[model samples]
Target: MSRAITSETKHSIISDFKEITKIRLSVSVVFSSIAGYLLGVESVDYNTLILLALGGYFMVGASNAFNQVIEKDLDALMNRTKYRPVPAGRMSVNTALIIATIFTILGIVILYTINPQTAMFGAISIFLYTCAYTPLKTKTPLAVFVGAIPGAIPFMLGWVAATDDFGIEPGTLFAIQFFWQFPHFWAIGWFLFEDYKKGGFFMLPTGKQDKGTAVQTIMYTVWTVLVSIIPVFGVTGRLYLTPISGVIVFILGLGMLYYAIQLYKKMTVLAAKQLMLASVSYITLLQIVYVLDKFIR
Candidate 1:
C-alpha cells in the first residue's frame, strides 16, 4: 500500500510539473525554434540542434510558468484561463515561481553552452515576456506590440543558436514570424474578446472587435505574406526561395488574406475562429514551403 501511494504521488507530481510548464505552449514554441534552426543552419549539427531545442523549450516554458504566476488573479477572473494550474489552485504560486526560476536558469545555461548569443536572446525573451508583456496585458492594446517582440524572438533565437551571429538570414526569419503574429493573435483576440475583456485585457489594436481592428489584422496578414515571399527573389542572402516556391507561397498568403477579409466583413466569432485557424495553417505551411524550397532548388 505504501508503494502504491508513492507511485500515485509521483504521478501527481509529474502532472503538476506539466501543468506548471504548459507543455502544449512549450511544444509549439519549440517547433518554431526548430523551423528557424533548420532554415538558418547551412550544415546542421545534431548536438547543437538538440541543445537549441531543449533550451528553447525550457525558456518558453519558464516564461509561460512565470506569466501564469504573475497573472494568477487576473487568470482566475477569465473563463479561458481560470482552469490553469496556478489559477485553479492545482499548484501553489511559490512552487510555480521556483519551477520557473530553475527552468529559466537551466535554459540559459544550455543555450550558453551552444553560444552566448543564443543565451542572450533567450534571456531577453524571458525578461520581456515575463517582466514587460505579462503586466502590460491589462494596461493597453499596445501590449500586443510589446508581446510580439518576445513571441517573434524564438525564430531568430534559433538562427543565433546555430550561427552565433545576427545577419540578413536571421532577420528575414524574424520578419516573417514577426508579422505573422499580429494576424494570428488578433484573430484569437477577436474570438475571445469577451473573455479577454473579463480580465481587462486589451488585445486588439482598437480595444474592440471592430472594423478598424479587422482592417489592421488584414494589413498585417498582407505584410506577413509579402515578407514570407521576399526570400524567393534571391535577395535574402543565404536564404533563397525559388520562383515556383514564390508562387506557391503567394497563393497560400492569398488564402490567408481571403479568410482575414471574410472575418473582417462578418466580424463574427465563427469568422474570427476560422481566421485564427487559417493563420496557424499559414505559418506552418509557409515554414514547410521554405524548407522544401531550399532542398528542391
Candidate 2:
C-alpha cells in the first residue's frame, strides 16, 4: 500500500509539473527556434542544436510558469485557465517559483554554451514576457503588441545562435514573425474574447471582438503575407527564398487570410477558431517551405 501510494504521488507530481510547463506550447517555441537555427546553419552541429532546443524550451517553460504564478487569481476567474496547476490547487506557489527559478538558470546557462547573443535574447524574452507583457494584459489592448516582441524573438535568436551576428537576415526573420503575431493573437483574442474579459484581458484592438478588431486582423494578415515574400527579393542578405517557394508561401498566407476574412464577415467563434487553425498551419508550412527551399533550391 505504501509503495502504491508513493507511485501515485510521483505520477501526480509529474502531471502537475507538465501542467505548469505547458509541454506542447514549450515544444512549439523550441520548434521555431530550431527552424531558425536550420535556416542559418551552413554546417549543422547536432549537439548545439540539442542545446538550443533544450534552452529555448526551458526558457519558455519558465516564462509560462511565472505567468501562471502571477495570474493565479486571474486564471481562476477564467474557465479555460481555471484548471491550471497553480489555479487548480494542484501545485504550490512556492514549488512553482522554485521550478521557474531553476528553469531560468538552467535555460540561460545552456543557451550561453551556444552563444552569448542567444542567451541574451532568451533572457530578454523571458523578462519581457513575464515582467511587461503579462502584467499589461489586463490593462490595455496594446499588450499584444508588446508581447509580440518576445513571441517573435525565437526565430532571430536561432540565427544569432548559429551565426553570432545580428544582421539583415535575422532582422527580416524577426519582422516576418513580428507582424504575423498580430493576426495570430487577435484571432485567439476574437474567439476567447468572453473568456479574456472574465480575466480583464484586453487582447483585441478595440478591446472587444467587433468589426474594428476584425479589420485590424485583416490588415495585419495582409502585412504578414506581404512580409512572407520579402525573402525572395534578395534584400534579406543570407536569407533568400526561391520564387517557387515564395509562390507556395504566398498561397499559404492567402489560405490563412481567407479564414481571417471569413471571421471578419461572420464574426463568430467558429470563424475565429478557423482563422486560428489556419494561422497555425500557415506559419508552420511557411517555415517548412523556407527551410526546404534553403537546401534544395
Q: Which of the numbered candidates is closest to the native, going by highest TM-score?
A: 2
Model 1 TM-score, all chains together: 0.95
Local accuracy of candidate 1 as per-residue lDDT tens digits, 1-297? 999999998998887788778887788788888888888888889999899889998998899899999999999999988988889998899989999999999999999999998899899999999999999989998888888888888887877877888999989888988899899999999999999999999999999989999999999999999999898777888888898989999999999999999988998999999998998888888888887877767
Give TM per candidate. Answer: 0.95, 0.98
Off by over 4 Å in 1: 1-12
Best by lDDT: 2
Model 2 lDDT per residue over 1-297, tens place: 999999999998888888899998888888889989999999999999999999999999999999999999999999999999899998999999999999999999999999899999999999999999999999999999999999999988889989999999999889989999998999999888889999999999998778999999999999999999998989899999999999999999999999989988999999999998999898888888989999997
Query: lDDT for model 2, on a 0 to 1 scale?
Result: 0.93
Candidate 2, which ten residues in sequence have the lowest lDDT sum? 24-33
